[model samples]
Target: MSQSGIDLDRSLGYLLKEASSALRTAMEEVLRPLGMSVTHYSCLELLAQRPGLSNSELARGAFVTRQTMNVLLQALERDGYVTRPAEAPVGKVLPARLTPRGQQSLEQASAAVRAVEVRMLSGMTETERSAAFRILRSMIHSLRDGDGNDGA
Candidate 1:
């Protein structure tokens, strides 16, 4: 706390937001030349890894809304980067899959994103990186559950 209010310099939440913004900016810079946005790359990567994820599932995985995902999926299908069946095999859920072009695009985008990550962690030791992974995962779980404490 500060006399003005919260001390942002010392606030974990503020620091996290700052870091996230920086990360997003860096990723965007790298992905721009590859003709991909972070969300676009995320969608392709998710489809590659999961193979048959629904639009809603992809939206969640990409941290975007379903409408946004739907629009992106439409564009991707039009561009031949991804495909979805004309009719759902099940209840209105059309699972998305990346086409060969999508896979190739993802490879380039992934490499660019990986370079950003490597730059981000350039100075950190292996142990520190491992700890960071665990801590970030814990924070994510705690925030998702609406509790700051993970009982650790």
Candidate 2:
């Protein structure tokens, strides 16, 4: 068997990476004025949707390391955007909740993020958008499941 370099223009992996980079750039542009990074917004949104989430849980939800999430939580706490008790109520797990301020901030950031998504899907019809969503979810599931050896 022989191998050749990828044709970047026709490569699904390359195209996905390119799309991810563009999406991140667009999100950053929209979030900057709101004084939020994607991670910051993610944490708040997570807390909002699932109140009393532990640091480890939030770290997973936000796709960040525990240490990174801890630092961000500290900053958010000091800035009065989030609240956690001084001591863990049980088992060294200090569940965090968004403060009213955090909720307000998240509302704005969510709106900004939604705008970026709308812009990204602007060219697609509703059916195309639904298909795109399903396809992307399937791709994520396949990658995460890691069922392999059938073919590359």
Candidate 3:
């Protein structure tokens, strides 16, 4: 080991966190005008891609607690952006699906988010982007493995 103090500027974990915070801030800037939070957009986007996902499933996907996702789902349903059956089809798990209004809203949010991502990657070469993706995934796997969370 080098005989020196730890340099946060060169710390991978610190850099990762800084990048994550910056990404979230950028996402919020674009989503705020549409009156949507990142979690809200993630939930809607998940439903759009995989209709009939349960609240718990969505919570897991969005990295929020089930209670938080449940509250958001209720609001979305009340606002007619999503619909749930009067009763769960089975096992008390109500599946959520986006309505036409939700789809339209998602279209706008998706465009805004895509713009942010495009700007983020504008300085990267295709090879660098590919390597970054692989490196991040490996880091996630290593961390999750140590924590005994296989992510199912």
Candidate 4:
């Protein structure tokens, strides 16, 4: 059988790409005044949520490589936004936590981030929004499973 025009696969891919780009642009605009990129904002948010997590753990959580995470950590440290506590007992890798300044920045950034999110979800009904979130999370889980299909 021959496929007709507007295949769902292609249409969905385009929609996802456009939505992602739009959201990223909105976030970057909100963060620009604070001299922060989306990458930096994400790192700060994650660190805030999981204080004292190791660099490797942070990298994994942030969906970045350890090298990329190291660079981000160095910048955060230089800006007095994060601190690596003194080494723990033998054979333990000391974890990093946000500094007071970091917490302050995060608080400020959170408001801006929330504004962006509100704008992004402006028109959706509550149930629609909930379903969309669930579907997206399920899609992520399926992709991470690496089964070469969306598992729909």
Candidate 5:
């Protein structure tokens, strides 16, 4: 126990944050050579799965601010990685889609990210892995429920 706070050595939240940080570090290491940050890779992955997603959607999916995602989307558009109509199809919502180049980039990034995930899970048995996945999902659901969020 800490003299002033919760016991760091026995805190699940602290341990979870540590694991998240480690995972981000590992993802960054792998994605750096591919010319992408974790957020960049996340944006591309989200777009690949849900083409024409708006800036706000990408921002939420990537755990980034809307302005941050907007800036990244602009860069991606300028670099020919993604495209958005000059005018919004609806009210100020320019849905973004990936270019072929973006898909190619995403393919590489996905492989690198997958390697990192595989390495992270290497120590866990298949059964343990499944249980861990379920437990994490439950934790997320519980937190969101407590906060009055459906987590949609």
Candidate 6:
């Protein structure tokens, strides 16, 4: 190891960041022809899975701020992919849902994403892939429980 105070062999953060960057790049490439950024695609996917979610809820699911989500919602609406129904009777918030076009786009986008995922994991054996997934899930849970501190 170099004198960077971090052993490359034990630097999980570095490894995870590098891998995530690579995967994100690949996903961007795959989604480019569909006129969707990763953020937009993510929002569509979440909406498809949980229709009629509030904008705040969609933001949380997409790991973005409500303001950013509003921008995305505007773009989707312009593209005819999403819509907000009329406000509820008195005090309830109006929920957003995917349009039929949005649903179809999401289905196509999902297949593209899955293809990229499969290509990315092709180097790993099935057993290795399963173990890696389990370990990553554990790490995600740990980080969630640790109040966002990685303790690095």
Best by TM-score: 5
Pairs clashing within candidate 2: none
Instruction: Report the number of clashing residue pairs per model.
Output: 0, 0, 0, 0, 0, 0
For model 2, give the 10-residue run with minimal summed lDDT: 1-10
**TM-scores for all predictions:** 0.92, 0.92, 0.89, 0.83, 0.95, 0.87
Each prediction's whole-model lDDT (CA) = 0.94, 0.93, 0.95, 0.85, 0.97, 0.88
List candidate 3 segments past 4 Å from native: 1-6, 146-152
Expressed as tens digits, the lDDT of each residue in 15-84 for candidate 4 is 8988999988999999999988787888889889988888788888877898998899988998899998
Model 1 segments beyond 4 Å from truth? Answer: 1-4, 146-152
Model 4 RMSD vs true structure: 3.6
Error of 6 at 21 (Å): 1.1
Model 5, residue 103: distance off in Å is 0.3
Estimate, for each residue in 28-144, the C-alpha lDDT of model 3 and write its tens digit: 999999989999999999999999999999999999999999999999999988999999999999999999999999999999999999999999999999999999999998887
Q: Pick the candidate with the highest lDDT.
A: 5
**lDDT at residue 113 of model 2 (Cα atoms):** 95
Cα shift from native, residue 64, model 2 (Å): 1.4
Q: Residue 24 error for model 4, in Å?
A: 1.2
Candidate 4 global TM-score: 0.83
Task: Encode model 1's per-residue lDDT on 1-152: one tens digit a residue.
Answer: 68979899999999999999999999999999988899999999999999889999999999999999999999999999999999999999998899999999999999999999999999999999999999999888877876655467
Model 1's lDDT to the true fold? 0.94
Candidate 6 vs. true structure, TM-score: 0.87
Candidate 1 residue-pair clash tally: 0
lDDT of 5 at 85: 100
Q: Which ten residues in a row have the lowest lDDT in candidate 4?
A: 1-10
lDDT preference between candidates 3 and 6, better one: 3
- List where candidate 6 sits over 4 angstroms from the true fold: 1-4, 88-92, 146-152
